[model samples]
Target: MKDLLGFGLRGRLREGYTAADFRADALAGLVVGIVALPLSMALATAVDAPPQHGIYT
Candidate 1:
C-alpha cells in the first residue's frame, strides 16, 4: 500500500504517508457515520418505519 502511493519519478514529492494518514482516515469515517445518523432517521420516518428498520434494510 505504501509503495503504491509512493510510485512515481518524483519519489521525494510522492513519499509514502505515515500512520497519521490512517488515523485521519479513520476519524473521517467516524464523522461520516455521525453525519449519516440523522439522515437515516429522517428516511425511516418518511417511510413510516423505525430507524433500525432503515439500517437493517
Candidate 2:
C-alpha cells in the first residue's frame, strides 16, 4: 500500500527528539535486551552449548 511504502520517509527520530523520547527508546531497548538475553541463553543450553555461543548465533 502507499502508506506502507512511504512509512520509512516519516522518521520519528528525525522529526525532533525530546529527552523523553530518548529515555523511552533507551528503556525499551534495555527491556528487550534483558528478555532476549535469557531466552537466547536458554536456547543455547537446550542445544547443549554455552550461553556465549548464542550471541554468536
If scored against the real structure, what TM-score would every candidate get? 0.61, 0.67
lDDT of 1 by residue, 1-49 (tens): 3556555635744586557886998999999989788788879989899
Runs of candidate 2 exceeding 4 Å displacement? 1-14
**Model 2 per-residue lDDT tens digits across residues 22-49:** 8998999999999998899899999999
lDDT of 2: 0.82
What TM value does model 1 have? 0.61
**Clash statistics: count for each candidate:** 0, 0
Clashing pairs in 1: none
Least well predicted 10-residue stretch by lDDT in candidate 1: 1-10
Model 1 ranges with Cα > 4 A deviation: 1-15
Best prediction by lDDT: 2
Model 2 residue 15 CA deviation (Å) reads: 2.9
Extract clashing residue pairs from model 2: none
